[model samples]
Target: MTIHSISARRANRSAEARVADQGWRELASELNNHGCAVMEKLLSPEECAGIAALYPHEEHFRSHVHMARHGFGKGEYRYFRYPLPDLIGALRTALYPRLAEVANDWNERLGLAQRYPADHAAFLKQCHDNGQTRPTPLLLQYGPGDFNCLHQDLYGDLAFPLQVAILLSEPGRDFTGGEFVLTEQRPRMQSRAEVVPLTQGDAVVFAVHNRPVQGTKGHYRVNLRHGVSRLRSGMRHTVGIIFHDAK
Candidate 1:
């Protein structure tokens, strides 16, 4: 789609529309069965390219992290500054309410008392009130030999439970073998690993730390972590939309 059309779509809240078309029932089912769900082509190639291009411009980001330097992994990423780009801001707002529904259900099933608000702005205000005022959305870049370590994206005590990452570069064409990976650690059971498939513009909405799993006895909390596998060749870029802020 052209930049003009993309702008028109965002202006008309197309993010919400497309997400609705994905069917909240089915999306929640997928999230409950697995720990993640893919929203196909949530962004256009042009839009992905535009966001990826912003990585080199430091003005758009507040902090840069070399993963290896922190013993996290081999890749690097930049945290977006306040006043996020138009598309990022729009998607964050549009996606939250739908995900919040699933999050609330999960919280109840897990016996957690925390409940998310119906609106993204209200939830964000709660985060800020708890001293998590810094933005958590980030852009990640990886090349050959680069990979992200298995970890959770918890920034503060006020975590939103779910987060999203949109692939900005095409597999095979733009890069290869840098797959999205998730691991589930259940009580007294063997851990399971899943490699999520994605193409350019695809977004995966996933659990950040914990999710409830149904057992014969009852619902139990399972630990979850996500990361990227090693890149074989070329380059990769992704934009992550994490709802909660950091200190």
Candidate 2:
């Protein structure tokens, strides 16, 4: 990339962070009400493509997963290394405080004793203290006939309640039928399936494990798992920002 391109990307990211700052309240409201929220066009198309391009470079990743080998699904993904990409790191930093506030509120409602720190660094320090030193940010790639199994992104003992996944490939043009799928399981009710709509540069923020729901007597916990439907054609790529580190 040229210096001008790099500068443009930085400006784009700055603008994106501003958007997150302004929209966080609405986003939190959606999370409290629906357990998920979509932030549209958080990244520019060039930025998205830039991120996806990084996936092929082995030095940027600490580990790779063939989802089928682990029964995770049919696609593949790679966990980022110690030094995350500039864009990813900025996103993790910019978005954490807002999500932390939502997470703290949920903890109170659910009667959970643990409260998260206000910033990502402190929370990460806590994770590292608990021996969760592996970075969990990842890039996932899906091809035709590939899919992801429904699952939570919780890494270790300490997990952030919310996580974000940004679509790096155009839905209709770059891939087909690989929709973002989320499932919610209430205590005594049948699971509800939600298909999230996302285009290139869009991001979906959701509960990483469980969310609190209002019940007749009190707040109850509902489990959530997210995945992708099988792609009918072409290739897809996504950037997952999992706040917690792995063991």
Please provide, for model 1 over 108-212, each residue's C-alpha lDDT reduced to its tens digit, 9 standing for 90 to 100: 998889899999999999999999999999999999999999999998989999999999999999998999999999989898999999999999999999899
Instruction: List ranges where model 2 is wrong by over 4 Å.
Output: 1-16, 19-21
lDDT (CA) per prediction:
0.93, 0.91
Q: Which residue pairs clash within candidate 1?
A: none
Q: Cα lDDT for residue 222, model 2?
A: 94
For model 1, state the Cα shift of residue 78 in Å.
0.3
Model 1 per-residue lDDT at 2: 95
Per-residue lDDT tens digits of candidate 2, residues 1-247? 9985686578648955665655777888889888999998888899999999998899999999999999999999999997788778778877888889999999999999999998889999999999999999999999999999999988888899999999999988998999999999998889999999999999999999999999999998999999999999999999999999999
TM-score for each prediction?
Answer: 0.95, 0.94
Which ranges of candidate 1 are over 4 A from the true structure? 1-12
